[model samples]
Target: MRHLVVPFALNALRRGRSIEQFLGAAGTPEAPGIRWAELRPTAEGFALVVHLAQDIGGEGSYDLVEFPSFEREDGEEDFGCQIAVVDEPLAALTIAEKRLGAGRDRWVNQGMAGDEYRDYVRAGRPPCLSASQSEAECPET
Candidate 1:
């Protein structure tokens, strides 16, 4: 995992200060379990996109996971896992999750972006989240 995580500092933000390096992992990019995931820059923070099977009896599609990020005094962040895939465009959707992770999560048809997503994130590249996930936390030269 070190080979893949040496670049991003998400762990820093995900669990506060994370200096430990993952040295063991077993899989190739060609592996079947390798799901497609990408980070999207949003005005407030970032969103995740992954291509995978939708659900039971459902075909695969791009699932966007938008976890509400909240920082704690202990340095651990809450990654609200409420997952869902807006069948239509992001703009035309509204998502709501139950508190304490109970009940079913729902989304309504609505537009999230009036024009585009960048219009929300200050119009430039988002700053590095943390040192572990810092843009500069790269491997040795």
Candidate 2:
């Protein structure tokens, strides 16, 4: 799985080696998706940027997603901000993962042109809720 390669990529970035990873098939404007993620070492830590699958008339583009601050196992708090340099390679990759995860349900996840999407659309695009119907769902924002 692609997840297994993430740690090695992070290690390479931490060693000052910029890395680019192709995440999924290219997408369209109607449903933008993450094409690749770039990691560049920085003075503060590192910068993570992702190329959007759909470009503007063939021109390349990038987008960043905000990740909520999470408590670290050591009891430290993360900044929980987007487009900010991260202090650790794993942290930067974590942000990139969060960005990639945002589009986890897009058609690209299935394939370049998988028929499963048609069935999903016909099925009313049911969501993968965190809790079952028997359990309380997260309150609406």
**How well does candidate 1 score on lDDT at residue 71?**
39
Candidate 1: 10-residue stretch with minimal lDDT: 99-108
Those runs of model 2 whose alpha carbons end farther than 4 Å from true positions after fitting are 1-7, 25-34, 53-82, 102-141
Per-residue lDDT over 1-141 for candidate 2, one digit per residue giving the tens place of the 0 to 100 score: 322255566566667876544343333336433234456787778876544323222111122222222344467553322244788877766665565442222212112222332333344434431111211111223
- Local accuracy of candidate 1 as per-residue lDDT tens digits, 1-141: 222232233333233221111111112234311111222333433333322211111112212123223333468553322233333222111221111111111111112211112221233312221122111111232
- In angstroms, the error of model 1 at 56 is 21
- TM-scores for the candidates: 0.19, 0.41
In candidate 2, clashing pairs total: 0
In candidate 2, list every pair of residues with a backbone clash. Answer: none
Which one is best on TM-score? Answer: 2
Provide the lDDT at 75 for model 1: 81
